[model samples]
Target: MKIRRWQFAAIILTIIWLFVRGVPLDPQVIFGELLLGFILAIFVTWGFRRMYEGQTNLSHGARVLPYALVYVGTFLRELIVGNVDVAYRVLWPSMPIEPVTVYMPLRVERPTAITTIANSISLTPGTLSMDYDDEANALYVHTINGRDPASIVAPIRRWEDLAIVIFGEEADPSDPAPDIQIGGDIDGE
Candidate 1:
């Protein structure tokens, strides 16, 4: 509900509107579009103002950009690596794959951070975030290979390290990650 929060949302929406509309040829038209886009964006942001209310640290906000950039880089790297691994398995029928569910307990308990982590896991290849245990604050992740749990977990933990700072989460990266429980039907049953 804060003006500052609404302002940021409106500014981002205006940028998106511009991208979707594309730049006009004439100078006057370009200026007109920008002005209209911003006006509409402001109104739209105001309409959804309630959704912006959540735990936010203005101090952490300033530091978040750098960490966010790093997290994106890590995510992309993992995405590419996952794609290659899945592709390899697809090409080679003889490749051994042990499918299992991993219980990944998160250090960050905030809703936004938890959702981000869950979506990121689901987005990556060969891994899916199946369910969330609210009481344990843990996620059940299904991966193509569980024989080397470290390989599957390493990237996720790296993401968490950056996410902690990016989302202004209270969890510390130095805190030990809980031992992940791995078990599932080994066969494709």
Candidate 2:
């Protein structure tokens, strides 16, 4: 209470609230929306702050902005590319489709980081997040064409790196990613 964690939360939450409101181009409208978000975020952060207790640093939200933005851009690019690749495979018929599942160990131990990475995998075409082994902090990802596990895991590792920063997880992004294991069964193949 003395450090006013709520102030930091309010600032970060206000930015998120404004974003969720679809930032308008008009100056007056933008100011109005920001004012409303500021008020709401204060209540929300203060009211719900009990859930955020025990975190090592509650003030890292602003520092996370750049990494979060980069993660979004990277995810978006992979989404578009995956969609095109999947569409081409669907249309061409002869395109290679060697489905395979891989187990990827993660440096990010937090649920938020793991879930973000898992969801990103599922959202991208030709890949699905079948399961997560929480004990190991790893994901089971199935890719349509995974002859090369490295290729399938490259973007995911990128996202994980960003998520570690965004979530303020204990892991260091500079640390090498764990070795991936080819795993699971895709139609018994």
Mind sharing the TM-score for model 2?
0.76
Leading candidate by TM-score: 1
- Give one digit per residue, the lDDT tens place, for model 2 in 21-126: 9987999988998899999888888798886664345457667878989999999999999999999999999999998889888899888788899999999999
After TM-score superposition, what is the CA distance of residue 96 in candidate 2 from its true location, in Å? 3.0
Which ten-residue region of model 1 has the weakest summed lDDT? 180-189
Which residue pairs show backbone clashes in model 2?
A: none
lDDT (tens digit, per residue) of candidate 1 on 1-189: 324677777777887887889886888977887899899998987898887655344566666888888888888988998899999999997999989898888888888888888888999999999998999889889999878988888988988888888876777999898877877432232
Q: What total of clashing residue pairs does each candidate reach?
A: 0, 0
For each candidate in turn, the TM-score is 0.82, 0.76
